[model samples]
Target chain A: MALSHDEVLHLAKLSKLTLSSEEVLHFADQLTPVVDYFRELNEIDTSNVPETSQTTGLVDVLRTDEVDASWVLSQEEALSQALKTHNGYFVVPAIFTRTS
Target chain B: MNIPLSISEVQNDLVQKKYSCVNLVEHYLSEINTQNKTLNAFLTVTDEYAYTKAKELDRVITDNPHAIKEFPLLGMVVSIKDIYLTKGIRTTAASKVLESFVPQYSSTVVERLESAGAIIIGKTNCDAWAHGASGENSDFGATKNPWNTEFVPGGSSSGSAVSVASGLSFASMGTDTGGSIRLPASFTNVVGFKPTYGVVPRYGVISMASSLDSMGHFTKTVEDSEKIFAVTRGVDGRDSTVVNHSYKAVSPTQKFRIGMPKEYFAKGLSPEIEQKVRAAAQEFEKMGIELVEVSLPHTKYAISVYYIVQPAEVSSNLGRFDGIRFGNNRDSFGEEAKRRIMLGTYVLSSGYYDAYYGKAMKVRSLVIKDFDDAFSSVDAILAPVSPSLPFKIGEKSDDPLQMYLADIYTVAANLAGIPGLALPAGFSESGLPIGFQLLGKRFSEPTLFELGKKYQAVTDWHTKKPS
Candidate 1:
């Protein structure tokens, strides 16, 4: 499936990336052949094989029973990592300048 | 003895207090200071902690020497792959995206190795996110081969293998999804071991193809690899993929049976490498081992199957790497990574998932069945780790398809979830190292180690200097 320009933009947003218009066009070209290679996987036959949820033929990985505790970091500590924070959380520019 | 600088010579020195743990730490760190610039093997060097730990160990040795005796890796230095979490230290996976990120916890393997008495030298470089077989894919500058200045040290475990090969550290931890460990080891004339799938825990490791990603080791010798595995193998509650199986402790039986796959011996294999592999086979025969020709009828399609399955997993595994989680912003991520993500996404998307990921998984089953059949009649399978000797750095770097095929010989083991060991075969006439591997049954590493140690004992292939 050739990636649509809008789909690429959506994926980039989902991936937390912001691509310029020219860069998007260039990336679209580079992503074309790679997508074509994966398209070949559609020809494979998996009907007889059990769906592999995970390798190691394993299921039901249980979490550790032991509970460990750690010193808590305050909101001040959490917000220390950001260049901009509002209240106690990191803040970023709106996804869009304004809602239409 | 200067406290026995190399791992092979250090057991006795460490056993006695003549060299003291403090002295050995200083010795290796000093060597690294002078030698690391030329090798470019480490991304960080943990000198302060190493010295402090060494001094503390000295007090422990004085108070209770017996306690320290249980530790086999005492006073050893280990270089960690950048992908594993090393709480408080950066773990970037060679991508620009997580430059400032540090994990809140340590990886299980790192904790185990530290408890075993090995001091971490620092995190090392890899192909970005363990994506490629060559270190060139790194967001960090490429790691040059230690042997020759102009060649690449294979990747995505590039710095790890180069560190051990050039003696920047005693050994290094590397992850192998598809020849990432062995490819670089072969290039540098070191021993790179991929434990049987599920043998080592992968929790806290930056996952790459969760089904195939294996936490492995890079060492200067096969014996050292055995020691590393003995300490690192076990069940971890963190990685659900880890198997509960333990390898047989015994070595190969008398009249060992080794098989060569006809598929791996076909065209595109260099005449020199073919000759080297043949000689190595003959040497095994001289050791009273049996060499038989085997057919893995499905081998021809192993690469095709691997590309489909791996990229499909890459699509899912890498979904978290949007600019927010890890990895660079769209612009900072290298071209190769973007290419893989796009390809993977396309294959797993609607109308294509069944065709690609589904078919690849089916073919994977056939490949595993092929190994099961072959191993029933043979002790282990031997083949060239790579079809050709190391090529010049830029020769195949630009050609993605040709570069992907470089892993053709090594990917089957990953596809089948088996263990493979890459050891130096011989050198090309041009002085580059060539390597061959012995693929063993799941959890049958002792067999490969025994064979590798014996071969290394007779030939100095493992000892030759690139210079």
Candidate 2:
């Protein structure tokens, strides 16, 4: 269950995080025991036990489709915390490029 | 009027016109100004806003005495943990990611508290993103235990506990994902109540372990905790997980059968904490309440399951913090945050999902079942809040697993989605406060509160000040 160096780097990428090389070594060392701890669950007989996504038994609790205007934040308010914004939309690194 | 007043005392004083709301607030701010530097309890002090609100409320109190009934929390001051968003107030969640980010909208609970006439005095410090049990996880700096500044304040509700313990605020709103409120409350000798999941709206608080988080508060007394709980509990459309039903208070009598989990008293629990908690359990027995010994066989697996599930949820929830849309880029996340995210990503990764996350979820059901079985026979369960008393600063900083184990007795409540109340049990031999927790069935806060009131009646531990 010990996470390899490359595996730790891959996890950081998957988590949308960038770890310094030092962090990789540290996390790799720390996370191994934590992962090994998870192995304890395997000893329990969970063959037919259902997975619990939420402790509270609520499921698919949908509200009315209409918006409550009073509580809704304006576009400007919503974009106020954005690190990069242009006009009313949040700006992000471009995800696509046209290649012929 | 005295500088430190309980919620009820403040109300009575306000009713008799002994002091204006402005005066009470000023006294509280003055205390904060003097003690906060050493306590490190607050992140931002909202002086102008607090004074303005208190002065306006004082006008209403002066104009019509009966008008106070409309605002139940009228004239009482409370602090909000930085994890809960407040409009125009900088909420760091004790992390650099949102160091200067102020939300345009306030959280649902804060709105409810304000409408009830509670003035926002300041923002308290906490573990970043409510992540660690120790206050050391905070990027701002660790909050000092008001009792002894040298010792660490139990956290991630560290500041919330410190504020109440130091007489700065009557109560503080804190989020408990995994004993964030209760653990600190134990260390500081305050009342920390984590209501059942889905009881309080989670709309404005920053998300951490979405399913595990519950919005609760720290108070000087169980009655104060109940009063605040009544105001803050309920469903808001924004947080669909909240329950729509109201909690009815039930009185405790001889018929109460409280359970003591045998596993909790086992290895790792400090001898002093176990002794104090056992003494408190004996008091309940003296009240004619039967104490039944029960076993939660899966107790050992709780910390493991929690670490897995919490990290997985944290990774997914933290995904919103991409540079463009949120406060800052992911790089700003601290070492603990990065560690959790990485652990989460590794577990939920395609091939490993079934082995780690999937298996952990199943064991989580067993942990819940252990409680369900125990609750069937007993009205509630009594256990130590933490395995040991609060340690010194930098004691567990280098070791993550050791820090995680500090929440041994507490994480089970979060995993089971039950209401857990931490109250002053007694003090350790060295004079540090030791607390025991009473956990009741989901939404059975009334039973826990009733028992807590009974316990506090016989014991003056909760009333003892740090000094």
Candidate 3:
């Protein structure tokens, strides 16, 4: 099924992406056939088949809840790559802003 | 003196005092400086880092000749795909989002390789976020196929394959979530081995599809690939999916039976590729091995299931790159990356989750079962790596579906979580490289390597240069 422009825009919003009007049309045209192609899976009968989310058979692999020094990233190092940082904390766009 | 072709040769020359490790590094560095403009294989060249390591290695070679034995990859020049995080080095994943992002820590693969004395020459280019089957999806620039610069190098491990094919590095590390490693290897005429899922830890490598991604590498020879695998494989206590197990080494003299899956040779495969791959299989029969015709009934559904399951996971993994902590804002994402993110969001959304992601998982189980049933009858499966030889640049880039089809023969191995080794089969009439892969049971990497070595023993295909 062809995705409508609005549907494509909805997906873009959910994905946190701001697509251009041209991109919305382009993606709608590009993704429609791919989504339609996914219909091929419906041809197979999978009534009783269990989902295989992970192929590794390991389950409930537990480790002690302790810090591992080797894997740790210091606060300074973690904030080094952020575009905005203040007092060793990552700064993100404000979620709530008061009106004047 | 001529450049060494394999790891053993590089070490032998070092031991013989034919050339210092610094000389070797300089040679590869000079090659990159000259050829990278045309090939666009490397996104970043670590000239200073490589020179420092080479100088240190040169000291060890002079002071304690026997100490060189301890370092398995001593003096070996290698490259990492831009997707892996290398501490203090810029890792872009070939996308503008992470254009100047310098990782604070290195991947487990990088640390392990360095500890074993491998000198990382640079980070190679690939499809942004490891999304496409052709190199054209890279945000930096498409990596040119060394054999014919006009043709595309199969990707998302595009530049890793090009580096090995063009002699920029002895071996290059790449991640294969679908056909990333094998397709590029096939297009560029190198040996690319994708180990069984969870065999290699994905500690700091950029996640594409967490469950499906397998860390692999490209090398000029199967033996060299095995050496790299030895250092890189095993559980690192970081990635929970990594299994702690040992692969039984296959005796070189042991006889074997290989299966040729009937579905893989079905319509749409180029007749020339079929003939060449079939002829390569016959070389094993001449070695007194048996070949059986097997069937994977769920084969046709692999690509469709992959598109669904992979994107679902990609949507989840990419959620971390929201520009809050690391990479640039979502606006910097390339077109292919945006398309995948949007497609994934649509599939995993509330109303469609069951129909897309949930149903795709059930089909994935069927794909796994197909491999289980087939492996029971034969020790391994042999198939063409790609349906056709490398196409020209811009040939299939316009149509995403056509680009996805380039991985038709390869995605099944990733879906099944089996180990696959793609090695040179022969060259097409137009001189493009053709390759075939050997698929084995989970953690059967040793057997696959042994088979690859056996095939390489009789055929000179892997030895042919891109000239």
Candidate 4:
């Protein structure tokens, strides 16, 4: 089944990506076949099968709560790669735009 | 000085004082200067850093010859895939999103390799976000196959394979999420070994698919692969998935039972690849090893299952690239990355989750079980790395599904979390490299490497270089 343009846009929205109208159509065209290809999984009977979140059987692998200095990035290093930062905190556009 | 073939030769020459460490670094850097223009392999060449490292090593060689043994990788030059973060170096992952991003810390693998005295020549190019099989998806440009420039060097470990194949570096660090390392290694005729998942810690490496990604490398010889593996594998405390298991060298006199998965050799595999891989299996038979014909029934569903599971993880892993921390906003992602993200979102979306992501996971269990059953009978499974030989650069770029299909034989190992070693089998009639992979049970790298070493012992395929 081909993904409609609106469906593609919904995916883009959920993914936090802004796509052009052309990209919406393009993605719809491209992703339709891939999604259809994924339908092949329905043919298999996996009712009793359990989900595998990870290959390694290790679970709840925990370390001591103490901080190790070697891996700790200083405040300067932490904010180093940000495009916008102020007073040691990353700056971003307003999460809520007010409209009245 | 001519480029040495293996790490042992480099170590021997360094000890013999045939050439200084600086000469070796200079030779490789010069080769990069000459070949990289056409091959488009290296994204960054660390001439200053390499020289500094080499000078420091030269001092050690001159004064503390006894301590030289401590540095197993002394005088060896290696390359890092752009996906691996090198401290203070720009690691792009071949995407414009992180184009100018300089990492503050190096990966565990990098830190270990450097400590073992490996001189990192540079960061090599790869598919953007490691989303594609062919290197054409790289944001910078496609990495050309060293054998035939018009043809592709299979990716997402494109430049890593090309670097080792063309002698630009002795070995290269790469990630194999879904045959990223093995496919390229097959295309370029290098030994690409993807250890079992969590064998090499994933900390400091750019995430593709969190669950599927396995850190691996490319080398000229199986023994060189073993040396690099020794330095890289271990728990680094950061990546919680890493298991603290040391490598055990296989006995030289050890015999083996190799499996040929019937499903892998079924229809759709290129006849030439089938013949070459069969010939490789025959080589094992000649070594007095048993070749059992095994069956993996769920093999047909591997590619479909991977598309679901890998993208689901990719979507989650890539969500961190929000421009606030490191890279540019979502717009900087290439077409392939965007497509994967969107696909991942669609699958993991509310109503469709169980149908797609949930189902893929269950099928993934079946795929893993197939390997478990097969391993009970045979020590390792030998199969073609790719269904076909390397095609021309522009051939599969237009079709994403066609490109994903190229990963059929390789994704199974990643899903099963098994160790796979891709060894050069022979050359095609057209002279492109052909390779076959040995898949062993989890943490069976020693057995796979032993098989690879035995194969390389009689066959000169690994010695043949691309002209």
* Runs with alpha carbons beyond 4 Å of true place in candidate 1: A1-54, A64-66, A70-100, B1-8, B251-253, B322-331
> Model 1, residue B310: displacement in angstroms?
2.0
Tell me the spans in candidate 3 whose CA falls farther than 4 Å from its real position: none
In terms of lDDT, which candidate is stronger, 1 or 4?
4
Question: Clashes in model 2: which pairs?
Answer: none
lDDT of 2: 0.90
Largest lDDT belongs to which candidate? Answer: 4
- Model 2 C-alpha lDDT per residue in residues A1-100, reported as the tens digit of each score: 6889999999988888888899899999998887887787878999989888797788899987997889888888888888788878888898999898
State the weakest 10-residue window (summed lDDT) of model 1 chain B. B321-330
TM-score of chain B of 4: 0.99
What TM-score, to 2 decimals, does candidate 3 have? 0.99
Instruction: State the lDDT of candidate 2 residue by residue for B174-222, as single tens digits.
Output: 9899999999999999999999999999999999999899999999888
List where candidate 4 sits over 4 angstroms from the true fold: A97-100
Cα error, candidate 3, residue B391 (Å)? 0.9
Q: B79-101 in candidate 4: lDDT tens per residue?
A: 99999999998999999999999
Candidate 2 deviates by what RMSD? 1.5
lDDT of 3 at B255: 74
True-vs-predicted CA distance for residue B445, candidate 3, Å: 0.7
TM-score of each: 0.90, 0.97, 0.99, 0.98
The chain B TM-scores of all candidates, as shown, are 0.95, 0.98, 0.99, 0.99
- Per-candidate local distance difference test: 0.77, 0.90, 0.92, 0.93
Runs of candidate 2 with Cα error greater than 4 angstroms are: A97-100, B1-5, B251-254
